[model samples]
Target: MAKKNVLIIGAGGVAQVVAHKVAQSAAEFGALHIANRTQSKADAIIQTLRDKGHRMPFASHALDAMDPAAVEALIRQLDAGIVINVGTAFINMTVLEGCIRAGAAYIDTAIHEDPARICETPPWYGNYEWKRRDDVAKAGITAILGAGFDPGVVNAYARLAEDEYFDKIDSIDIVDINAGSHGRWFATNFDPEINFREFTGTVYSWQGGEWRENRMFEVGREWDLPVVGKQKAYLSGHDEVHSLSARYPDADVRFWMGFGDHYINVFTVLQKLGLLSEQPVRTAEGLEVVPLKVVKAVLPDPASLAPDYTGKTCIGDLVKGSLDGKPGEVFIYNVADHKQAFEEVGSQGISYTAGVPPVAAAILVARGTWDVKKMANVEDLPARPFLELLGRMGLPTRVIDATGDHPI
Candidate 1:
């Protein structure tokens, strides 16, 4: 049988990495197509591929992913067996519906977010994607949620702990430290609307066997990691914590993100000024616009930062529990260099790390290893094959414990 076609939504930094990686691994897929709200952005990504000397058959389409009919139409037109939804988190449900209606496998990098709401509740997956469990199952399709780094590989790390290290996991502290710098005075590595919204809301975590709430940058601790050295990470709300809590309720699951003092100061100022609000307000000219979106518009596009970005990122899960009835802890992580990533895929390390995993998941689905034909979170799937494939694709897994830091 001919390889299946894959359709990727969104034309952002992360999507660029996905497009390039998928193009590199073209033999595993049929025709590769990428769509975005603006066809120009999608064409830009295709052009980047051409500039890199890739000779695969690639196509670009204009898609408003929020419209399920249009999305389904595009999927059908492309004959795509797999739909990678890397668009804004707000379009997840609509894109998921399209995938189901079109009989295509669905994958996404983050949890769905309402354009109007900041933080809804813990177990974020239970709020949106989990509601479609029956729909995905009845359609006999695979839907992988949170295929990005934190929710993606970090979730797999928890599973790896269960499979290899510990008999009972006590706590899972996911530390995401982007030690890389994009050489900007003030800029987010990803979409500003999503990035600012994440910090403006109440930070929710799973602790003490229940849901706990805290302010952004409230609780923090210094961690001496492998490459990044000593860095302070603040407890933050994230997608994996929600699903992982459901999977391992007995364990206290929390997400900690490292932010430099400058970022915290800038973010605090923006929040205090009410510039990060998602609600629409009338401007002086009597036109309504969402402040967060306006801020996003003013911010540098994340993709544009790749050329000047330097340094490395260390993201991992520090799981503490018992092994053979003895106390133990293991840190499963990956260290990615921005320069190396930009050299490989015209995007920075942050994008490259987040982008590579879904393609790995897609390859597994195409290979019949992860095509479970059911709705699943990253943790719910088997861990070994996905991690191994990711290692080969660029983001290799490393484990540090009483033994030492070694590749998986």
Candidate 2:
């Protein structure tokens, strides 16, 4: 098969890692192009690739990803066969449309969000991306949603349990613990606006064959994970649960994320004061400003945390089910070190974890392993291939079963 040209549609921290990973595997791909709202940001990524002595064909462009016409034009200009969208979640639908129109395979790390809304309806994919399923099928182009670590790899983990370890699945509990510290007073690991938006609304989980809603930080549990050790995680809504529940309807699906007391307190203050609202409010000077955007503007960019970031992150799926007509459980997970990620890709662990998997998915598309040519969530495809590819590409998978801990 001919190599596919790849285009990355964001210039954020995750995009940096994506660029590096793609360059490292450039021989498997054709030309690489990156486009962002700021061309300089894209250029910086290309410069980093060049600094690392990657001589792949690379170019950068300034783009308004929200505009489908602009996105389609860029894809056509490059004849990009695969588009990796590490861009903000707000641009997902538009970028996906462009890919479909340009006949390019589409991949994104998160579900799409409306800039003016937070935590809209449930089966969130149905509210946006899945609405375009017929269009993607008609176009006959592969579209993979939520291909990041939590949603991406975790989705694959649940599938792995179904495929290899379970007869009848009972539950999938995804735990995300970031034991890393950026040495900052307070900062989000990714986009502050997006991060805050995630918690400002209702938390949704799939339980009892229905969507259950709760406030962020309302439900908590202690997880004795691998590298991160014992940590407290709160029940939270996430991209993987929606799709995973659909695939394993009999299984209860829930996502839990670790948060320090400091973060919770600060988040509570900001949220209570309406500082995290996506809706605009008038200032004393009558300037219309979005409180959340203003707060985001004042916070340190998530990309800047890499240099001082130290520690590790443990994220995975703890699956429970029946095997041989008996109860059983397995924890399928990965432990990523922030400093190691910085040394390798100039990105912190959060970005590194979220960034690497989409590129792996892209490689599968290029190699025809995951080129299903339809709109599918990560779990909709085969699991082992994706996990094994991730293992070779820096994020190795481990599992704890009745037999004990071992590599997958």
Candidate 3:
């Protein structure tokens, strides 16, 4: 296969990690390009590459990814064969369309979310991405959805269980625990608006072959995880569940995320006060503003917290099923340290974990390992090669089974 030039959209925390990792693996690709609404941010990332002595041919561009025509034009201009979108979730569809038009492989971390709507119907991909399945297929370009850690790695974990460990799968419980602290009074790991938008809506999980709904934080369980130890994780709606359920309809699929009491208290107060509302309201000064955007503007940017960040994150899939006619369980996980991530990539663990996998996916695409030339969730592809590549790319995988815990 010919070397594919890479174009990365968005210059946020996750995008930073993606740029760094792509630079580290620059030999596999023809050239590297980074684009964002703020060209300066993208340029800063390129400067960081220079500071780290990565001499791969790289340039930055200003892009408004919401405009499909502009996105297409940029992709064509850069001749980007693989477009890594680490932008806000709202731009997924537009970026995917651009890739389709430009015939570039697409990859993103999260599902596409509407700016006006909080939570749409279940199987979120159907609302936006999956609708373009025929387009991607006809275009003959790969589009890998939800390639980040939770949705990305966790999806692969489920596939790994089905492939190697399970005869009849029963359940897939994805737990995400961030024991890291950015030393802030309160701030989200990623975008504050996207972070708040996630929980403010109904929490949906797949159980008993049906979609189950519950309020956020209404269901909580203590998980004795490997590195993070005992952490309380609440049942949460996530991207992987939607795709994973379609693949393993007979098995229960759920996502749980750890949150401290302080976070709960503050989120509750914000929700009750309507500060998390996405809808615009006219202020007393006759200025219409979205409450959620205002709160996000007031909060510290998620990227700035990396400098003071400390601790680690444990995120994985705990799969339960019958293997060899006997019930068995396995937990496939990865632990990332914030300080270590900062030392290497100038980002925190959350950004590092979310950022690294997509580059791995890009490498797989460049090497023809995951270039299926169609739309797919991470689980829809082969699991071993992706997981093994991730292991070699800094975010190593670990397994805990009846035999005891060890590296994958």
Q: Please, what is the TM-score per model?
A: 0.98, 0.99, 0.99
For model 2 the local lDDT of residue 28 reads: 87
lDDT of 1 by residue, 142-175 (tens): 9999988988999999999999989999999999
Candidate 2 segments whose C-alpha is farther than 4 A from its true place: none
- Give residue 268's lDDT in candidate 2 (0 to 100): 97
Q: Show the lowest summed lDDT stretch of 10 residues, model 3.
A: 118-127
Superposed on all Cα atoms, the candidates' RMSDs to the truth, in angstroms, are 0.9, 0.8, 0.8
* Model 2 quality (TM-score): 0.99
The alpha-carbon deviation from the true structure for residue 371 of candidate 3, after best TM-score superposition, in angstroms, is 0.6
lDDT tens digits by residue: candidate 3, 300-359 = 999999999999999999999997899999999999999999999999999999999999
Candidate 1 lDDT at 120 equals: 90
> Ten-residue segment with the worst summed lDDT in candidate 1?
116-125
Alpha-carbon local distance difference test for all models: 0.93, 0.94, 0.94
Query: Candidate 3 at 210: error in angstroms?
Result: 0.7
> What tens digits encode model 2's per-residue C-alpha lDDT throughout 80-184?
999999999999999999999999999999999999778988888889999999999999999999999978999999989999999999999999999999999
